[model samples]
Structures are given as structure tokens and as C-alpha cells.
Target: MDIDVKTLRTFCEVIRTGSFTGAAHRLGYSQSSVTAQMRALERQAGAPLFHRLPNGVRLTPAGSTVRGYAVQVLGLVGEMEQALRGPEAHPQRLRLGLAPALAYGEQLARISRFGRRLLPGVQLALRVMCTAEIHTALRNGDLDGAFLLTARAPRRSRTPATAGGPDPTSVAGLARARTAVLAERACGTAAQPGRPTEVLVQELEFIPSTSASTRPATPCRQVAVADPDCPSQRWLPEFLRLRAGEPPESLELGSMDGVHATVQGGLGCAMLPSGLARSPYGAGLAPLPGVPRMQWTVSLLAARSREIRDTHREGLATALRLALEHAA
Candidate 1:
């Protein structure tokens, strides 16, 4: 079967992600495009490759056989390309990932411009995903770098870089990464009002929802949280439990936007990073009272094993700082 490297790469991504939509997102292609590419690959192979399922695609027997050869072919192609282009040659592309919450506004535009300017001919690709996914991609070498939004410097963050020669799981190299304090605001309920402020918002009432008909007196102001895998939203539940002595009513949303919309609609309240709370994402949401204000840190991170030139690292750091400053 005749297949090109680009098509092979797309096939691998689909297999890796287990869904056309996910592969499209990672490759920056439309979902339909990914679907068409897979169909074409199947045509070439003269057999079906995947069994479509409600949750995700599963490989067929034919697909499993193709995968072994495809991997070998891709590895050989990579080796050929590397040999053709001397080891000392400059990198032509850099793939970077960002936490979903920080992937909006002009910050991305600013970073893109700076990246192009710094690398000259290098093509910079940015993808938005959960922090855990970003870390996984960096460790797998699918991403050259990432921008992470974390609650704050936890004790583990104090881990020293180079202690064991580039541990991807620990905060080793990332501890010294250039960090920006996104915002310091109260972590509590939000609703129609002005932007987040130093003061804890106390205007929200426990309005009961009609959906909770079984218990009329029960408060409908559920705690809104993003997907479980999202690092930025992970702290809300525990904080609520600590403040209220029990788990508050929760409304799990698929995305940060959904969480913000729920709170803005007066249906629920959310505890989030103060910076995200102040950005346009949290616009018109007032922080609730009782919950303490917390600081959120956004860091530009690179894998320690990746040999990024100091100039390139500084350029990326400067871009992030400038973006934050301009946003401010």
C-alpha cells in the first residue's frame, strides 16, 4: 500500500487519541478532515481499520497489523530525515501546549508572534489541553514545551532541578521556570457583577433549583467545576469541603467555559484560580464570601531532557511576561 508520511502521522495520531475529534484537535485539523484521512487510509489498506464506538474508536485486527508496520515506517522516515538534516541544524518547528483556561485572548497571539520572531523560520504550533495531558505530551516528546496553570507553589514544587537528571514527573526543571501570578482573589461563588476583587463576594443566595424537586429546601446553588482532569478546577471541591464541613452540591461541566456560563447564569458558583477568575472567562462573576483568597501561578515549562537553547528559552519567557503585562 502506498501511504505518505503525513498520512501515516495522522493515522498514528488517531490511534493514539482513539477518536477522530481528539486527533483533529491535536493535529490542528478539522474533525471532518481527520475522518476523511482515516477513510482514505482504510481504502489503501483494503480493509476497515477501526470499530466506531459511542465513546471512542477501537482498532480492528487489520488496524493492529498495520500499526506495527506503520510504526516501523515512521521511525525509519524520522531517521532518514535526521540523517539528511545534520544534527547541528536548527529546529524548524516547535510544538507547545497550554492549559485550557489560559488558551484564550491576545496572550496566544502575542506568544505566537514572539515565537516566530525568535526562531525566524521555525513554525510554532500551540495546542490547548488539560495540564495533565500537557505533561504527558511533553514527556512523550509530542510537545516541545507547555504553559501550565497551577494552584500555587505546593511543597513538591520546591524539588530541585537536576537532582536525578531530569525527572519529568517532578517539578525539577519546572521549579525555576518563569512564573507569572495570574491573580489573587477569593475562591468562592461567582455571579453577575463586576470583575473579581480582593473582597470575597457575599451577594449570592442559595437559590434552590426546580430540578432538585425531591428536596425543596435544598440549595440549588451547586458548585460548578470543570472536567475532573483539569488542574485549575481540581482545588474547588476540597476547598468547599473544608469551608462548609461537607461536600457542597456540585455541577460538573465539560469545560471551563461551561462552568463560567453556569455561574454567570446564576445557576451555580465556582471556586477557581484567582487569575482565571479575573480574566474575561470570569467576567461578571462575583466571588462569594467565607472562602479565602488564593494565589495562582502560570508557568512556561520545558522538559529538562529537551536541549532548548538559552536564547530560545529567554525569548519564550519574555513573550509570556509581555503578554501578561499587555493583558494587565
Candidate 2:
């Protein structure tokens, strides 16, 4: 009948990390102490919260219900603390992560400026990272949230599931692959609805470099960011194999600018976000016909244990959406 905020906090941490050991490490407590807190919490709730698993724990239905309330309770507690301390006494510091592909031109600067003005007393800390690193940082509680470029799920109406439907292995192979990997897995799991919905920001076209010569002597190479194995960039090599009729040679660049520069120099063609390809920076690039379009949604992913205020989170998402639009 009596559960304290500290217990709820520990419970949320366990859910965020998916293990008591991880929660303990993050909370600077002994694993046994975390175990005791969970047991006590279960006692207070009069039901099992999590089902023990070999690798980690999973929330039972009761646990899931408890978690929903726990998050709200914690948020209210946070708001109370903030209200009592006042904005000046406890300034909000949001550590946000972003992918390099989304930082073209002056977009990063634009985001920082807009975020500051919108939040007023808040400090916006931004880190440019690859998709994989961003996900990892979010899980580990190192970042408050992240803006990722995710592939949009195909509309149910647009998707055909009837008999004699389009072959899954046909020309739309890359599109199907992208949907399975990026949309259903990355974007789908990253943000839950209501708390902070994923905002559709931009659509990207993965174009083959026009700079490639038509001569057979000049083979088109696949250009990608250094961390091409991440979900967003991972499909490029496969796309090339399907598009070019062979496993094309690949050129890796550390930054999006470098990739664009190399591709424009005719070294190779890279899959580019539409924002970058359509910008003044991409003046020389031409869109590849018959290529399927992938829409990117900016997901606001934060540690469930440390929820950003709903207003603040939504405002930041709006700022990002508008900033990207202006930059584009």
C-alpha cells in the first residue's frame, strides 16, 4: 500500500536497463540492494512485477501497468522538485544525440539556436553520433534523448498482401529490406506513442552518383559513412549489388560532407538523405530513377527512467522538425 519514489525510481531503472545488475551499476548501488528493492516493491504491489529470465527480466502484465504509473509518478515528482527549486535554481540540461547525416549545412547550429530560444532557461547539449552509438548511449543513460533518421513504415493501403502480390525478391528488394530493418525495428521500437510521438521530419532518396562515367572502364563504387554498418547506412552495399549487377567497390568517409565531396568528385555514389541531396550542397547530384523513397522520422528517445517533460520533449521535437525544414 506504501511505495516510495526511490523504489519506483529503482524499478524504472531495472526496466530501462532490462536487468538488476545494470540498474545497480547505473544507480551506484549493490546488485543485492537492487534485488531487495524490487522484491519489496513487488510486496507493496501484491503481485509479481517481472518474470525472471536467463539473460534479463521482462515485465509481467502487472509490471507493465506498474511501470506506466511509475513513470508518471516520477514525472510528477520531477515537476514538483523543479517547481519548488524554480527554473533559475535548477536549469534543465538536455543531452541530445544526432546522426551525422542529419547535420548537413548549418542545421546543427540552427537546432542549437532554436532549442535555446524555445526552452529559454534550458541548456541544449548536442552530440553528433552514428545511429548505433546513439541507440547505445540512450540505453546506457548517457544521453537524455536523440534525433534519429528512421525509415517510415509503408502504409497498409500501399502494402500489398493479397495472393500473387509483388515478389519480395523483385526490384523492390532494397525497399523491403529497408522497411524490415529500419522502420519496423529501429523507428518502431525507438518511440512509443503519446509520451512523445515520432515526428516525420524528412524523406531521403538514396541516389547513385551522376558523376560516375558511363564507360565500362569506370566502375561505380559504393560510398558510405565510416560507420556504415548502422541501420541507416547498412543497406547501401546491398543496394549497390542489386542496382549495379555486382558487389561494387566501397569508399568510406568519416563525415557526410566527405561522402558528398567524394561522390561529387565521381569517386562513387552514396545513399544520401533527401535533405542533403536536395540542398545547395548537393547542387551537382541528380536523383536516380526507379529508386524507392525512404522517409525518415525523428524519434525522441530518452531513457524511460529519466523522462523529459512532455512539453519540453514535444517542443524540442517541433524545433527539430522546423529547423530541418528551414535548412532544407
Q: lDDT tens string, model 2, 1-328?
A: 8999999999988977889999999999999999999999999889898879899886653674466456546655765776687666877778788776665544665687688788887766776677667755665568777777654432221322434323323433454454345434433454564222444544533433445333434545655553453434555566556656687676666456556655655666666665656644455566443334344345565544444776677678777877777755
Which parts of model 1 are misplaced by more than 4 Å?
Answer: 1-91, 150-221, 227-231, 252-255, 272-283, 304-307
Winner by lDDT: 2
Candidate 1 residue-wise lDDT at 45? 91
lDDT of 2 at 321: 74
Predicted model with the maximum TM-score: 2
RMSD of 1: 16.5
Provide the TM-score for each candidate, comma-separated. 0.48, 0.56
Clashing pairs in 1: 191-286, 201-287
| Candidate 1 positional error at 274, Å | 5.4
Question: Model 1 scores what on Cα lDDT?
Answer: 0.54
Off by over 4 Å in 2: 1-90, 151-207, 212-219, 230-232, 289-293, 305-307
Query: Residue by residue across 1-328, what tens digits does model 1's lDDT show?
Result: 7788888888878877889999999999999999998999999999888889898886654664466456556655754675577757645666777665554333455566666676676555666666556656754667767766543443222223323222222321232232211221211233523212121111111111122112433333477765444433544455445445676677775444445445655666665433335533344455454333333455666544434555555666666656555544
